[model samples]
Target: MTENTVESVRRALDLLRELNRQRVSSVRHLHHATGLPKPTIVRMLDTFAALGYVVNDRRQGGYQVTSLVRSLSAGFHGDPLVVEAARPWAIAFTRKFQWPVAVAVLDRDAVAVRFSTIPDSPVSPFHVTINNRLKLMSRALGRAYIAFCPPNERNLLLRMLAMSDDPEDEAARDRDAALTLLAMVRRAGFADRSATVEPKSSSTIAVPVMLGRKVLATVGVTYFTSAIPKAEAIARYVPLLKEMAKNIQTSVVLLEQGGAPNDGAH
Candidate 1:
């Protein structure tokens, strides 16, 4: 609205802000949210799609922001590459399995959910989980991250958690027992969400996204306990989730090198 400010630029930013606010958006929603004209919003969304910052996914029900927006948005501080690498694969996994997939990265004493496919999942356990921070020992995503990261880094994280008062980090108090529990996760090749977390009727299984033993992030799928037995969910979903994590790793490398991701990873 300023005399020197370009109207188009301001409008575009407004559109982008609205797009980023919603997990998925359409022209109608953008217009309603930003008070922008429908035609203008459509044009901007099309431009975003052509520029690879937005993807129109019918299954997800609208145009969703792609990881390319990480540079444009200053909210999330985790590794953008990991989020970029996991976005498509996570969506694919959710679409195929009908169970929501989430990607998280280490954030201080905990792991933060950076991306989730709940919008694509018809049977998602939670309405939305993005930005939810999970403890490094109790939640599946957090346990996978700490259990798979290097020993030095894990120890540092544990020490940090030990000094914290968050109830979720209570497991860090018993270092010996905590290490023993994490050792089991390492051996089991995945982490299962502790039954103590909210929504006890639902559980998550997570695996680390590793590039040569250096964990880039964690990916998980949540399912209802009543719908699937513990043994069946673990036996069937674990392998696929692990494979998706590996595919994300490969895609991360490729993306960093300015190449298209390997889409045949399913």
Candidate 2:
């Protein structure tokens, strides 16, 4: 491709990615998210709409992607970009430490595990499937994300959690306590849960994966509480977990910059 053609393709992909992230986004939102000029974004969105890859919603005052975009990943695996980026490192960490690790991202009011090494971990005693969802206010993964995410996003997530009907989300209703917990997580630079959300014998330490000032996801390591004390676990495993998280963040950023293969390349 010519130089201008390559640049155009990159910009188009960036716009498409921003749309995918937001689901429904206005030109202003696209401009902000992709750092593209408003006129350029409008033109690209119009082109995408004409090509049936996106739909312009006059009523909603935004643009939404169409199923045509799914064709781009028709043969792809289920994991998202962050999961793909973190998979090798997560598995390696588990292999080295004999402790299962999970990579999770915020999904609405809860955190969703996008990648996990538990099932395949060499040392995992139980043959258990990964839990896809965890409460935002009570789980280490969720708290790590909430604590590290930008203030506007953290506030929005808190509001969503507070509106949840689940009794466990009552912590979201206690603004002071919730804030205090998040403050601690931020100060400590990691979140810990001991027999709170998991089995009595299990505990977890989670840290956020950051891209710039924004948290892209959380990486966590889980172990049997009886096997390792909380202080020892924090001291021994937290650095490794944070390192893996940082590496994953770097991989994701490079992938976003077109340094790696597309999600479906696998």
Candidate 3:
């Protein structure tokens, strides 16, 4: 496609994202937010709706997002490196902890979960989904990645997220919390997420997958709050979590060495 065609598609997608942020928005409001012509905005919305990517409210004269975006997400989640690098940790972590485990990567300001394994848990509820982006500030794994990311890159990620057209103050707070957690991780060598799901029954522990000083991704274990008591969660798993972090680091180093010559270390 021509450059103009690509740019048009991008702008249309941006319009859709903006509509999603407003909960619902009218064509005139979209024209105001995006500076696109009202007729063009209406046409794009109609096209998007026909494709099941968006839905309109006749009463409100507004539109909202649908599940079609997730169909696109399925392709991105299938990337080889993301799959190859994360799947082993997912399997190994679940086997060891008897809890849910996930491997995730930072996608701009979002956390993209490539895969997750849910353990049988009678006590705690499972809420996370594969291919879903977690709230960057609220999730332990996302925070761990942000905490260990190199200073410049981390700062850039934060700034870009802050200035995004779909800016989220909650996401910024999460980044701050992640920074705080990173500092604690540096000193203590592991990160924990307690009472994240229910006041009584869910928690998590996360570790960064580092390549030298850079953070490549994160691995985490989650449990129903009741399945593992708070004290036991830390006592039994923290050390093993650290071990997994070390192994991930070593693996990164090996992968770097095995890459085509002159590919700079991550």
Q: Using lDDT as the measure, which candidate wins?
A: 1
Model 3 lDDT, residue 136, Cα: 49
Tens-digit lDDT track for model 2 on 153-200? Answer: 988888888888887687899888888889988999899762445566
TM-score of every prediction relative to native? 0.70, 0.66, 0.57
Error of 1 at 223 (Å): 0.4
Q: In candidate 2, list every pair of residues with a backbone clash.
A: none
Question: Clashing residue pairs in candidate 3, if any?
Answer: 137-174, 201-225, 202-225
Off by over 4 Å in 2: 1-78, 126-131, 194-196, 260-266
RMSD of each: 7.5, 16.6, 11.1
lDDT by residue for model 1 (1-266), tens: 66798898888887876676557776777778789888888888899899999999888778888989877768856557889879999999888899998999888889999988876777663656678898998899999999999999989999999999988889999999999999999999999998787878899999999988798999999999999999999999999998998889888888777765544653
- Sort by lDDT, top down from the best: 1, 2, 3
Q: Pick the candidate with the highest TM-score.
A: 1
- A best-first ranking of the candidates according to their TM-score comes to 1, 2, 3
Superior candidate under TM-score, 1 versus 3: 1
